[model samples]
Each structure stands twice: as C-alpha cells, then as structure tokens.
Target: MTSQSISTDVYEQAAAWLERLDNGPLDKLSKRRFINWVDAHPTHKQMFESMLITWSSPTLERALADAKQTITLKDHLRCTPAIRWWQTAFICTALVIGVIAWQLTPNQPSAIVHQYATNTGEMRDIRLEDNSEVTMGSASDVYIKFSDRHRLVNLKKGAAYFDVTSNKQRPFEVKIGSASVVAVGTEFNIDRGQYFTDVVVHEGAVEVAGSRDDKPVLVKAGEQIRITGRTLGLVQSIDISRTVDWRSGWLELDNESLHYLVERLNRESAKHIRIDSPALNDIRVAGRFRLKDPGQALNLLAEVYGLKIEETAERYTITRLP
Candidate 1:
C-alpha cells in the first residue's frame, strides 16, 4: 500500500482503539491483540499516540458532546462509511482549533494557581486536578500552575512526593530554586533543604536540570541526585524505601550528619532544636526515629552519639558531652 493509504488506514484504526480505551479497560486477549497491532507497524504506534493526545483534549470532548446532540457517537462509529468520514472531519477540525488556541497562548499566564501546605507535625495527601497525587511532608509548601501545555509545581519549602499521571502532551515539572525536575509519568520525592535540593526517583525516570542553560541529567529509578545552588551533583544509587520513610511518620537515617538530622527534626518539632557546638554539626548518626516525637528522637541521638542536650523555655540545644 502507498504511504498515504497506510496512514489513512492507521488513523482509522487508531481512532477505533481510542474509542475502545475510552469505554473501559480491555480484557487480556483484547490487550494482547492491541499490543500486537501496535507493534505491527511504526506508523500504528505513532498514529495511536497522536490520536490519544487528541482524544484526551477537552476541545475534542466538547466537539463530540455537541455532535452527540444531533447524532450518537456510537452510531457514527458503527454506521455507514459517510458517517465515519463526517466524524473524522469533525474531530480533525476540533484538533486544528485546539492547536491554534494553544499556539495563541504562548505568553499567556496560567488562569488559576493552586497552593498547598502542611503545618508543623502535619502531613497531607492532595489530589490534583489532573488526578496526580502529592504527599506533602511536615511544614512543606507547593504551588501548582497548570496550563494546556504544561503542569508546573514550585516547591517553596520542605518536601513532597509526586505520583504524576502520564500525559505526553503536557509535561509535568517541579521547580526548586533555579533547578527543575521534569517527568512524563513517574513517581519521585523531592526534598528542598536549606542549601540544596535533593531528588530521589522511586519509579520510572526523570530529567534533572540545574538551570535552563545546563544540560539535563537523566536520573532513572533507584537513583538520587542533589542540586546545590545551580550545580547538579552526581547521580547516586540509593535505597528508595529509606528515603521515603517519612511518609510513614518515621525518619530513617544512615550515617547522616547531625546537622541534617537536626534540620529535619525541626520541621516537625514544636520547640525549636539548635546545635550549640559547631564541632557536633558534622557528627554522623544513624537510626530510625518517630517524627511525632522529636524529643525522644533527640534523646536517642544523644545516647548513641554521647552528646548533651540542654533544655530552655523555648528550644533544645545540642552540645558535645563535657
């Protein structure tokens, strides 16, 4: 068959697949058949992906809804060849309009901004409009701005775990200072520290860019990267479970500095924690402690490291044992 004929046939098959997917999940046999069809030709996969993007567009949905008022979509799909041709033309027109509208908004700001935060000792689970989920850690803050082309999140303070839904047409990005993490469909945790931003990918992969001008580093699953200022650190292999232990109200440490431990503890502690002895800041400690009880956590640290804790009306000071 000629290229033009193959493309037209593939486009129709892609539309049919889109309809089937929209109805519901396919059975195992149907899934296998669909996979085989997708693998049969490169054009099949490309056409299906393009159709998926158009199928999920709000403009196409609106156009379909309007057409349903005059003629049922099911009838159009299953009926005469003329009806199918009309349906295809209508959907193509809607896609063209959507593309034009998107191009016209190159400089347009997002219409709405959504902000979410968690208080001291508080953790929150938030569901975004795109059906993505975010687990906000104690004293964490995030601002979400979604447009037709992109979904942007600014991590203002502390940490958050994102379970992003897959959408190739719109990229999901998390901004931390001058750095940003971009992903298509993945789960990852981001911790914004005082002087650095840490990213740990639990599933799939993400591209980490220290700045817009710098080349993006691909951090895959079972990997971690720290962005200090505008520089991207080495990508290191990590225990993903240990990094996300905070979701269970536990802080798991493995030879982390005392300064790092104290800084994390202060986020959930009602009374402030301060390191009085500068020498103690570099002390490496390891343990799993409950985030709900910062005092007990500190006491355990002191016991293990042979440190002293002085209590006042407001804060607890950690010093070297004298």
Candidate 2:
C-alpha cells in the first residue's frame, strides 16, 4: 500500500476509536480490543495521539469560544446554510476534545458536576468525563464530579455498576451516605439501601470505609462489604454472577427476603408491589427472575410460595392464600 493509503487507514481507525470514546468508556472486551489495536502498530499510536493534540489545540478552543459568545449553538447552526467537510469534522472533534479537556484540566474554581437518574423500569448507561462507565439501575440517582485529583460519584439512591478507568494521579471513589469505596481502577457495584450500603468487587480491589472507621477495609475481587451508618461489615466472598446478572435484565436472588425481592421488583415495575401480610416480608426465597416482566416474576413468586396476589389498577398486593 502507498504511504498515503496507509495514513488514511490509520486516520479512519483512530477516528472510529475517538467516536467510541466520545460515546463512553468501552466495555471490557472492547477496551481490550482497542489496546491491542493501538499496540499492533507504532504508526497507529502516533496517528491517534496526533489527532488528539489537533482536536485539543488552543486555536480550535478559541474558535469555538468565539462562536459560542456570538450566537447560541442552535442559532449558529440555523444561520449556516451548509457546513463544509472540515467544519463538520472540526465540530465532531471538538466534542471529544471538550470531554478530554474537562477531565484533564487542573484545579479550577469548581468542577463541573453532572447528575443522572433513571425512572421506574428504566436503566441508563453514562460515560463520565474521565472515561469511566456507569450502568445505573432502575430508580437510581447519581452525581458525578471529576477534578485533577479525584473522580467522585455520589450514589443518592438505588444501585449502579461502575467500571473505572485507571489514572494513578486521580483516584475514583463512590460515596454513599457517610461511607465511601475507593479504587484506582476497578469494577464494582454499589447498592444503596434505606439503612445500609453494599459494595461488591468483580475486578481489582477497593478500599471501603465509613466516617467512623479508623482504617479502610480492603475488599478484593470476589469479595463484598456492607456499611451501615458509621460501621463497616466484615468482608465476605460472594458469587460474582449476582452483581453482573442485572445488566442482562435478570435478577438473581440467593435466599433473599421477600421484602428485599419486592423492593427490587418495585424499581422495575410500573405497577408497584406491596406485601399486604406483614409476615410474608420475612419469608426467604431464591430464584432468578426476569426484571423486564415483573408481572411474571410476581406470578412465579406467588406459585412458589403458595400465596395469593391481589391485583389493582395501580398495584399488586401480596397476601396469604384465602
């Protein structure tokens, strides 16, 4: 191949990877594939770095800043009859560079904070400024802030799985109430309950600590820890599958209480579930159920426990069999 053709191929691949990075941090498999591609050829790495530097150039930043000051984005687009090829490319490159700049910049007056939330039966995947990926569960709320020294996420409600990108200079932390789980680069899931929080690590390790703890507990892969108020629970080995199943639209229950099951079901179901019989809340059950179809899950639960479910317009009430 001619040098020109080789350069074109490299540019195309680099642009594709940049687009993916813009969308969000890649999944584990995709990330591994990306690393392999970068390592396969020195030319590929050089081209990618060149593109990044070009996009983040001060000239482009000044141009964009001037355009923003003069007119709003929508107005600017409306005023332009047709965009040139280079202009279109610049716009796209600017977006990716903007994210990178936001992440890598030093201390400012304040960090840009982004908040994300999911409604009932809804899930969301978010890519942070630092290229960290967060998979939020139904009825979840998270606030993110990235600075030169730290990448912070506050889990206000529900559960989320975090796949953090490594940056030794800046550690990643998830804050739940007065407790925090810290990691340099790792995969972990945090579920915030009314009175407690659970942290499960699938890859690498994390330090878990509460406000009152003197030392943070190191929870490694396949291990789990729980924090309640100012206290941290003992670390224990757990099935990794339990943390991953939710991403595939399945909830794997392992001898969890009926109350806990119902709470999870409520997050994924429009028609809420309520345990009318107080005694049923303490009953233990275990099964893998489909989160997408909560009605079916409730039916299965009713069958397995020999209970009755009273259906209403707004909710399903679980009660003892008549």
TM-scores of the candidates in the order shown: 0.65, 0.64
Tens digit of per-residue lDDT, candidate 2, span 1-322: 9987787678768756654554444665665566567657778766665444322333444443443333333443444422232244345446543433332222343355556779998989998888889999999877676766878777777999999999889999887755688999999988887667778899999998774133789999999988986689999998776454567788887787898888888889989899997889989999989998988998999999998888989999999898
Number of colliding residue pairs in model 1: 0
Ten-residue segment with the worst summed lDDT in candidate 1? Answer: 97-106
Clashes per prediction? 0, 0
The number of the candidate with the highest lDDT is: 1
In candidate 1, which residue ranges exceed 4 Å CA deviation? 1-106, 241-244
Error of 2 at 267 (Å): 0.9
